[model samples]
Target: MAGSAFFMACAILVLFGFCVEAELVQHTFKVSNMMVRRYCKNKTITVVNGEYPGPTITAHEGDSLAIQVINESPYNISIHWHGIFQRMTPWADGPNYITQCPITPGNSYTYKFNVVGQEGTLWWHAHVSVLRATVYGALIILPRAGVVGYPFPNPHKEETILLGEWWKADVITLQNRALASGSAFNISDAYTINGHLGDLYRCSNKHTHKLEVEQGKSYLLRIINAALNTQFFFKIAGHRLTVVAADASYTSPFSTDTIAIAPGPTIDALLHADSHPSNYYISALTYASSPAIPFDKAASPYASAPPSASPFDNTTTVAVLSYKSSPPSSSPPIMPPLPAFNDTPTAHHFYSNLTALHPNSVPLQIDQRMFVAFGLGLTPCSVNQPLCRGNAISASMNNISFSFPTTVSMLEAHFRKIRGVYTKDFPNRPLVAFDFSNPSVNNQGSFQLTDKGTKVKKLKYNETVEVVLQNTAVLAAENHPLHLHGYNFYVVAQGFGNYNKKEARKNYNLVNPQERNTIAVPVGGWAVIRFRADNPGLWIMHCHLDGHLSLGLAMVFEVGNGPTPSTTVPPPPQDYPTC
Candidate 1:
């Protein structure tokens, strides 16, 4: 009997090897213009695979996937494989201005890379600035052989839900207007579930996407928050969701009735469908606060009125989480009791223990510290200045707008070196000073632009470093989603208001506090991160908000001295952008 069992095990191992060798798959997709009249209005918008929040591309671990992204739009475009480890695979990183030139209109580029890591929730999106607002989709990686379905029991069905923001106006025009006026330029009227804003308007009915699930069975729901600028709270009326993964990595499973997810974050949950058949709404609501308004105690003839209340109050339904009808004429499905936010003891303990296990893993360190200030206010222009002939309302980073360098050949070329025409006479300290809690500030603040913003702080190949990002309360009271390229970092510490230099030095989590590619700098707060500078390449560290980055809230870092000369790759091939 033991001999027979050994023979059966050997046969199973042979079959698995054969499957691994033969199961690799490759697919090519196109990014082109499609007529998607979202919200029932006959409007046209850019899309991937002729759909908003394009099709989900799935692959197993150890598989090589090739995607041929053809750009048929009237503008330049590029697709980034978000949250993937593209260390040596620079070509597939998809930074249009960095790794390669953009795929111009009527042009095509093939992105090929091996999926060499563990499997979890991943995604792809346009990485060329504003293009991501409209073009994004899910990239799911299934587990390798012999691994069980997930930490929890296998579900009856699985679904991929992507949340996106919709804009009816032209994206370029909307951006330009915001730049010129220096105010909120929200054109979106409704949030989208799988690309459709359901039942909000007459055209909403046409593009609705629905999920049909079975009653009394478990289901796996992979949720991706792909919205451009909104953080959301999600909950289903009749089911409890056990969150098992975050940011494409598995965490210890924690059950909750509601989950808060920020942009660029992904969460996977297991939902046990109700035994009795009943329809219920699966809702996602924005957690954004209203923009602050300047108060006027005395009313005048020309005083402006306050902005009206937003339509997205608590009662709005984001999506329906309905169970299929069953026999026996059942009553309403039972709802699980909600968990308190502070009661996330399992998550806290898991993250804390993980950090203890990996204590010496620091990624990026402070060879030199630079202070940057961001804020919005009215300021008088320099005499006969092109942009400031009068007092103009504006927003700035380090108190300066992004002026394209006239002498540079291109942004990518200029970013390759630490010292250049762009780095001349860099400032030693922040460019603005104001109260973060206050909505407005005085106009006498100083602003300057320097080449240091593009400079590279040198790192030995595979050296560990810790960076403390101090928020000095110099801008509006708002959280900034800080994103880094080339390497993911462990968030060692975070706190409200200015960073306590003494306290942070003693209690830093150098091991593990959730390694991530992007982190949130809290409103009126600071965050410290650690990363290993092992990947040799030019990388960007910037705010994820496209508008803020366009204004000047961005910088580049060049990690040099790799093992191979090919690490410093040449320029992209000619005819790169055919459009």
Candidate 2:
């Protein structure tokens, strides 16, 4: 019931990460219409600064950034500095209708925030509706100048590999058309590596991408899974990588042949160029853990190519990881063996092996704890729905499907004490309890579909909170990479199957748990995370799967104001968009 709408963001931020504040970094982003060819077709898309993948924002830790966004595209949009802790500047924590309103066509707004207590690979992407499908860029944060260096040895060089998806159909058209029928989703025609769809599909050879590296030198590859829906198995044909960090937070180095990451996740790995200098293939394969048949059925057009065995389509997106001595060759580069599309063991191993190199103490006394359950399900189709055959696909957290605000942003409503913009009545525990891992249990009347609302969890500032995220098997249970905006939380424990709070708490690593903004909740499993809600703002926690998101698998956390002004979030920007 704490409501007071606001606009006009101020530049005051209490520095947290780096003690010494550096000069402000400024950039101008002009969102405009651009036409480009992909999937053997010329398509017009929304691009930032006229770049397909958009321009990268690079800065060291403790640096403030003021990005002026001029939306020239036809669609309304807002950019989010994903994985960056906005501190007191929640107005810059963009999520359409959550923090600020969208920057409408022909409108402009400036996002001002300082990167605090974070260093490593993060990203920026559109926060409005479905615009993020084509608008995202890397936001790299390096170690503060002269204070320290990476936990691993310095790489000879670093490379950014932005893994994304491509669609022949205009995203706006495809999404709107699908939504109007109540069945829009996150599947794409093809995937891309740094904006190039390689030789996997027909007429794509001309747009292939290749990364050149020197032999016997170590390289840092910042791997970002920016795909709207697809989680991926990323590998190099003949090399192994030592993972050093994830989601911009440092982790103890763990070596692996391939990395499995979901959307909104980033892995910073060190690759030792130890393989033969032949043109090695860098490949990405779809990781679909859902048990349900996919909605997409576009088959491989080439009959000569053998059929694939993996449930997630075996169509691989490729690029050459060429050594300086090796050039392109007709001889087929060896393909790295990828685990099956639903390989749970491999995915679990990669996630569980990670630990915080610099362990922070977890709170011994928890202020609030909740068993939050989430998954895909069905809902009664509206009269207008045609894509769904009377039953629309939906997602929910605790049997409640989240619906965004229409009249004002959550911040606006909360600030102005508006009556109905949102409700802090978000359930702390599952409303209808059942054996969460049993796929058959959801057949019951209440479990088959969920009710909908605009709900949020209210938290007292600086309160310690623990969440046991239990994934349900209501539908095709998939590995969901859950992302929380505003603050990075410590991942203390994760496991498969229904979470037994008493038993699970026994194995909790109160020490040395990795801190991250995103955690991949095991399919039909659970993960436990703890964080101190010191930052005052209305934050979002949701499944990063775009399809799941569209179906309403998300909620908000409204952290109350702190004792002092510096710890409190101020008003929104003056030019904030209106509905």
Candidate 3:
């Protein structure tokens, strides 16, 4: 670990996307309690720097950042820089008990890392328990100062649109109740745009987030879906979005009336304000792919003007996109046509259509291949188990329910040779193969139960690996957004139904497939991703839905050290949190 003097003195000249001198940036986040009112209810929630959506962190490519988090709040917490390739600083890759223990209440920890290689929008959020419901903020990286221009024409300006969820009850309390009962958590009260609940709810029309734009000028919208579990369809009334990036990686620009964004990825789109100088509604609503789960009959009456169609936050959060020439009008703004809640085809088309902006040599040969079958499941209950009123609801991958270590972080255990914290015996494929995509198979005794343990898979450093993720229909069929912590992988192909090894290989897009840190496996379907295990550390891969993740839908990959020092993970920071 470097001292404050060295941190301030160390500077270097480098060329990555541009030539410039790299410097260290610093920020402080004080996690404290704040009282907020929404949907006619007042509640105290945990927040950073007392901001509802938290504070944004901005950096140029090649720059380093040192963010000190002061945990004044009553809960232990840690922050994860989503989509960042932590490089050699895996100790700073925050996921409670995975990378390091959470910073206890009144304690503090500084996250030091470098932003390199990638430039665009990413985000940071609490990775402990369920605090991410409110503890999230945007992380934006720009091209190095000396860069000439972006891949596409630079927009006249840029704006950050953070789509999120809001609840009337205390988030921690809500989660505890759900866990204690071994039942699904109650859905959110409403969805929000930049923390505003919009016109659909009471006392929100005046507080709705509004964006003013100039006619004929294009604006780069750095949109992030910070929702805990829901995927959203975002659109503006009379405007076309030219998507240029996903998960901070540039993509071939594609025009669309709407964008389908899952929980963990950030999207960059160019919005042209060419319509008549009038007010238009920019709306975001749940795109629920799980048709099997029934709708929430108790959904808040303030959710929307019309009833909700899905079980998840069946609400639309709105913002006004107004041209500079127009003022607030009494007439209602036009609403964009949103697909049905279970419009799987629309979601599929949006994901498969994206390709890399610049093609790179996608690995044609694989050194390792693995098939992972994952979904929700149930564990039979004993009369002694109080939490399991009937049967404990759970989820798993390859029939193994991931259990986290309580004494030390997984990375620490691997780094210091600590034993018994976890076992490197995670299965690469299902123990017993069956019809994974068939709804009827969910009734079978073999397919519905899962075993729990802290199991992981080991991989050789620098080995090219391919993983086929197949979503099962054990409990319900829903789109599972799986996020990998350490590296971005190429989403080569995706399709509905079981993945046929022989037939799926033929449809692989080896040339220009989209690269993403998070991929949403289609509901009752499968997707293929390929990447090289270059970074050394314990990297976690899990469903982005917090509920599913809590239910044990996750696993870890232990990538061993590489040949050279530059490719190896360094010693832990002196201030690394201890369990």
Number of the top lDDT candidate: 3
Better of 1 and 2 by TM-score: 2
Best by TM-score: 3
Shift of residue 499 alpha carbon in model 2, Å: 0.5
Counting only residues 3 or more apart in sequence or on different chains, how many pairs clash (N, Cα, C under 3 Å) in candidate 3? Answer: 0
Q: Write the per-residue lDDT of candidate 3 for residues 20-83, one digit (tens) a residue.
A: 6777989999998899888877788889999989999999888999999999999999999999
Give me the runs in candidate 2 sitting further than 4 Å from their true place: 1-21, 184-186, 293-313, 383-389
* lDDT of each candidate versus the true structure: 0.59, 0.83, 0.87
Quote model 2's TM-score.
0.92
Worst 10 residues of 1 by lDDT: 300-309
The local lDDT score (0 to 100) that residue 315 gets in candidate 2 is: 72
* Model 3 vs truth, CA RMSD: 6.3
Per-prediction TM-score: 0.78, 0.92, 0.94
lDDT per residue for candidate 2 within 1-579, as digits (tens), equals 223222111111222333445768899999998999888789998889989799999988878899999999988889999998899888888898888888888899999999867899999999876788789999999987656688889999999999988878878777766666556453577888999988878899888888888889999999998888888989998899999999998888998997989899899999999888888889998877666522212231111111111233357799878888876678877788878887878888888888888868787789999889998766777765665455666789998888888778998787778887888899899977888887665444456577889999999998999999999876557788999999899988999899987999898988989888989999889999999998899999988887678779899999999999898778777876777
Model 1, 396-415: lDDT tens per residue?
Answer: 44544433333332234533
